[model samples]
Target: MDDTPREEAGDEGAPPGGILDGTQEKSAQGGPPPPARSAPRRKPGKSRDHSAKRLANAGLAITAPTSRALGSTTIGGQLSAQLGTVAVSDTRGSVTQISYTATVSATNFTTTVGGNTSTISKPNISYWSGPATAVSGVGVFTPGQLAAANAIALTGSHTAFAVTSAVGNTSVSWNPTIIVRVPSSAAAGSYSGTITHSVA
Candidate 1:
């Protein structure tokens, strides 16, 4: 019998260490495979800023009698026309002051009947400020204070009157009185005239 070692039957084509298929190769230094390199992260973008603004304004209005008729009067007697309440409103900004003006159309009342002219001179018209109100600001009635005793006179020329020293919206109301003193020798036949009131 031959004494030579016998070769393994089906192992002739196998690799030296017999490594398995699908196994990953180890690092040469034997440490865990270097962590898989990751893609670099991006720095955050720069931030930006973002705001708003407005202006102030104002307005005015008036409510009062547009016309009146004082009936017959005796010779040398006085005729009084009581025009109803006169109310003024000032709509303004928070820091704005309130004021207004008053005016009359003419100083004298004139009429002509059958080509004969008649005149009523020096017609007295006045206002007494009463019952005032204010909102959203202080109420300062300085140069515009009105009272019965300190009534303001209306004439042909425009006259400015302060309504309030306050810094916001304000309102003032009052009754107006017109007095006409008839002359002893005056000839009357239903006299008519106009009185105009204005505010600013």
Candidate 2:
């Protein structure tokens, strides 16, 4: 009477295998274990920089010369002439103002070999601005305000006398004198005229 289901008396070593081979396998649908994949947080490696600037401008210049030859005089004699130095330099970048004008071709003093004339007008010519030396830059003109006894009387109606002005970046100098008075009814040869200077 054996029904074939009884091996329980004193079970011998037991490894005849197959109840899913002694079970310990998992995950057909687990929770909270899918969020441990943290290897993608490495995006912090970038850099940059840029900058630039510039500003520049400076221009203008002037220096006048030509008047040094008046060798003889005597006729109610009174002479003084040595028209030299009249300098000005402007380094302009952003501030500027300039003015100087002087002219005279004939107020008197003429001789055509045998037709003499020297009956001067305008108090016998004299226009001066001598004594001003500031050899650098910025707003110049000092030394008794360009004095030669502060003279001004040069006419033949060739009027343009406003000789001084500068506000920024300016070098300056001065010396211009001409005093002649020989009108004892002057009548002789060798006489000429011309003296002009300008700036703006």
Identify the leading candidate in terms of lDDT: 1
Score candidate 1 by lDDT.
Answer: 0.45
Model 2 stretches astray by more than 4 angstroms: 1-89, 92-109, 113-126, 130-137, 143-145, 148-168, 171-179, 183-185, 188-192, 196-200
- Candidate 1, residue 19: lDDT: 14
Candidate RMSDs in Å, in order, are 48.1, 52.3
Highest TM-score: give the candidate number.
Answer: 1
User: What are the per-residue Cα lDDT tens digits for candidate 1 across 96-153?
Assistant: 5544443333345555546896566644434333334332345544323244566554
User: Over the stretch 61-167, how does candidate 2's per-residue lDDT look in tens digits?
Assistant: 34444324443454555566655665545455335555433333334444433343434454676666566644565443454225667756666433223334555
What's the number of clashes in each of the models?
0, 0
Q: Per-residue lDDT for 100 in model 2?
A: 32
